[model samples]
Target chain A: MIPNTMKLFVGILRPEKFQLILASGIKYFAPPKNYDDIEIPERQRLRIYDKVPLYPSNLKPPKMQKRLRYMRGPELLHNKLQLKQYGVMATGGGRLRHEHFEMVRLQVARRLDMKRMFAIWRVDPPWQPVTKKGQGQRMGGGKGAIDHYVTPVKAGRIIFEVSGKCEYKEVYDMLRIIAERLPFKAIPVSQDIMEKMAADEKWQEENNLNKYTLKYIIQNNMGGCHRFISKYDHKWYGKYV
Target chain B: MSFIKKGLLQSPVPLMVAKRFRGKINVQKPRKPHFEKQLLIDISKPYYGPPKNSLPEITLCENINKKSYKREIDNPFERILAKECLDWFNTSKMVVFLHVNSISMEDKTPVFAALKKNDMHLRTYGKKIVSMATKGTRYEVINQLFTSHQNIIFGQPENAGKMFKILRKAPQLVVMGGIVEDRLISKNDLVEYSKLPSLDIVRSQLCSVLQSAGSCLVGQLNQNQQMLVSHLEKHIEIQNNPTNSDNLDTNAKSES
Candidate 1:
């Protein structure tokens, strides 16, 4: 059925799934004709990566996602004003394409967010060791990194993760199942805006944090775009956007 | 269980990001379908004496015909960059280490094609690759590719069943990773499980192999893992594997 301009909400999915979550109606494990098969509807992919409150000591990422949802939605929506959703994925690196499936985007991001949502699911990278010579303090170890469990990306929001051997859909479905089961709060967004954010690149640019001034989702101006980087490191703090 | 303005329950697993509305947003161009393929990223460990090769790594471009090159995208690109330096590695007459991940839900063909292209050796850990922990059929593709290689080692204890499928081709692919260390960290369960840091895991795996084929502390592994490795059939045996036992014992001694 052709869709109407219905304001919508969104979320990410968990990576693992129960044996029989879907009765089989939902699409699963279909081969793609090419890379174009993936898409994160311009609107649905309306997320701006920023380093807000890194952790939830007093403020957490969920709360941050919620607050940021409110802050960016209306303007981002350009007053069409719909809902938006944010899902996090635990990709050590950010590389999902601009056009992966909307479902996959939500699912993958939410799967990564699972570590942040629930501490039990917190799976740290298996090889990053602390070099600071301490029990807990690390070169990358900060209460923010641990408490937030996820680093916000600046420009990586465009790159869909292609790492490892999992198929895009398969990986997405697993996250969808998890999102279905996650207990984390769903921060409501303007469905209208969330629906159109990506397509409106010009408007996106208008709202887009100035490249030199504002740091973006996992965006790194340092030499090249690095992961887990921060505009917080820059001498011109909050001045670039 | 904190509820303030709305009725949002904070469970261990939150399902709030639900989209009861599947309304079709204006999709620009329809997404092109893609399948997962197996890729054998063969990196001959740096053991062939000094650094004879000019380039340390070779990354296959997204397009195969293109000469594989490398540029720091500010972080580790494509997860495993070892594939970039395959040329220098294979010809070096060195021990190649392939860190493999397989998921039952993926299509593992591309990875296989890449590995076969390099004419690389293969091995397994005799364990199951975690389908849940991975992204796509790509995991399965890698699984099938190496298992069918001329030399295969079943590194994953869980995937021991897949060992024969590989043994039928390759003589013996060296097997290591958590499988050798006896810890299987599935991505599915990693949401909350303990894993060595990514850097530490990478360092240990590479260092373990490079540092004198000796026993090493394998990725935050524990006593239980040690026992499991000791019992992996080949590690034991009073006769058929005496030489193997001697080396393993020496390594185990160092880890302790």
Candidate 2:
């Protein structure tokens, strides 16, 4: 079985994963506003959702003397709180200073269950906060200037590509649980499990009874959400009757 | 229990710290006044030190070299030291966190002095004149930390690890701590620290001989199972250095 990132991410965030994410930080993901269907290559799909390694990315990938040597059945699902936090903090055109990253470093490291885990960021120029209140009731009105940053990145969308080969089903269950429970709503639907959920009549009824009701469900969970309805495309798996 | 032991002995830095004060540190490092208690001792009415309190040297006098010279003991010093530490804090206090890992030269004497009087005040807060023990382990100090905090880190690695074992079984307990890496240290590292023959292992041995090691972990379960188990790590870090949390929000492209 040639393993892949999609399989890995699906396997970790099962229901039992809720407690970890609750403490770790919470936020799922939103589809990229400028998501391109054709451009994303096969290898880069992992980056689209999320992926963390047990070993340092910078370290040279060691040659496998024995395929068994590389076969540690390691797997992880991050703290839900962490995913949400990252979704809110990273998705928007916000730039996190170095130390802000460390606050959650311990949890992130533990999730990967590896020695070292690090991340770098590149932010697009964000919009300047409006100093003056908008006339009457405007979008960026009153309340201290609604600081907006513009980025090609999309916040509120969580996509994790977990790896390893133990209890992949549990991981999938965790992703579903984390997605629903996170503070920020990441479409409250999993691209990873859409196929399965679409096939499962019971799950579809529990999650998407009606076209508009499901929208409300996602919104109620995440409050004022914009689903990447387009991400699933014409072949939307969990399309309600 | 076995895991905790493995974690402790496997601590990143092995070997207990027995030295002290690398002289003063640069202002940049953690020169927090809290880390410099010896200064507090000196500035306040001569709490502890030499001249009159030296350990009796090997009895040079031939006549005195005989019999059980247990009377040369500075037993009173340790009692006085514990009283002073409690008094120094003013009002009552609990869980004296002596970093048994780090102690200084001047620090060693007080620990010995404290140990003599059965005092467990000093602990290593990173190699200095902070503290040490008679047998050279702050096991007693750790036992106290556990007694006071209970569900917090107990003295040994097994005790610490037991928390997670219990927590794994009862997730409602709300595990929390200083957030080492991301896992709460209270339940995380302390559990890891519980194992690995620490000063506690030696101290427990002594306590056993004295038939006095207290019952472990039973009283430590979380009655506050429903109450939020919060460790001050994240809130403190955010408050002191908002940027230190490593908040990565680069993907947020501003609404164009």
Candidate 3:
């Protein structure tokens, strides 16, 4: 006789309870088809939405001119240092469209898993809409309706920053592909490369090898005019003093 | 007595019994009441919610507000190119700036393609140059400018040779070095340098030569052992046969 603790029951009392209990059990008999067994047709699997209504273009209001140039000097140096991973920097300036941004974002997201790997949009998306006049329309009437929008990218501006668990070699090809497809010329740059460039620039400046200085230009071009100028002369007075 | 009563009685007796417990109740102390003033601050609602007019207005320039206006005349676009050029100068071992000023668009296409191809090569070599430039006390940038092309084809020794050949074919494109050594080389000298075997090829050749020399020494060492083995076999054969040994001794005496 089997002990009570060791005894096992083989019969099923309730059919519903049998399924609930034996759901995970190994099946000796063929299993019945459930709702999940039904096949979905390929055509009906994906649904497409109708055209979306267009909204009025929200253009950035014209404001007082601060600086004439879009981006000058090394303003993005700190930004580069902060996100010191493999990224793409625009070598030439141009307008980037909304579709371009979406395509790039989709391509990157598809290739790299968003959880472990991601990209930061260095440039803002196209917010200012540009309008075009209809063909053969009179020149003097009202302004044309908004056609499309674009984000004006300046040279030396970083368009995108891709970071996370990825090596430069692994990311370089993707970045190069993105760079080639971009409207403006762009180049793949890594943290080490940028750091090296910055260090080289600093070294050049320290050793006075940097020929861009005003003093160097003056010395080379004006033949040391500082010798003729009096030490007591007013600072504002031209080099003639 | 019943069996249950007998079992209970048979069990061990209780060790002790508890007596009635007693305690004194003390009066609680009176609680002290305290009053404090409360201050409220009216937090301003966010400007984005209803009534968009609450948002600050940005002043527009009269000229800019006009339908069509020209941008300011400034060369901001050139700055990036200048910076890139500076980087090339700083990083490259050699920079051969081809004077495409006179070269036609048709002629320039091939050159651009070649440059594009060379850029990939440069990237491969970029790491070595970067490391070399970043390390130690001396000016690595200057050293790199003189020695490394960063694997890029444009300033690479081989590319320089190819460029020399191209220059020979098309005399119009003048090559100028952005960062050249003080001691200048003629066109022929540059062509010669380019014709010379690359570092990899030279290293491989040296390895092969060493391998051959090692193999030759091993062969020489083995030759003496082979001669001794043959002599030992002859001596063993002479000792194994008395008649052959006697014939061998007669033959030796006759030969002497």
What Cα-based lDDT does every candidate model obtain? 0.32, 0.33, 0.53
The reply for model 3, stretches above 4 Å from the true place, is A1-68, A71-78, A113-115, A206-241, B1-256
Error of 1 at A123 (Å): 13
Estimate candidate 3's RMSD in Å. Answer: 42.0
Error of 1 at B236 (Å): 99
DockQ of 3: 0.01
For residues B20-51, could you state the per-residue lDDT of candidate 2 as single tens digits?
42433221122333323323222323222343
By summed lDDT, the worst window of 10 consecutive residues in model 1 chain B runs over B36-45
Q: Number of the top candidate by lDDT? A: 3
DockQ (C-alpha based) per candidate is 0.01, 0.00, 0.01
**Please, what are the lDDT tens digits per residue for candidate 2 over residues A217-236?**
33443322223222221222
Which scores higher on TM-score, 1 or 3?
Answer: 3
Best to worst by TM-score, what's the order? Answer: 3, 2, 1
- The single-chain TM-score for chain B of candidate 2 is 0.16
Best by TM-score: 3
The true-versus-predicted C-alpha distance at residue A7 of model 1, in Å, is 41
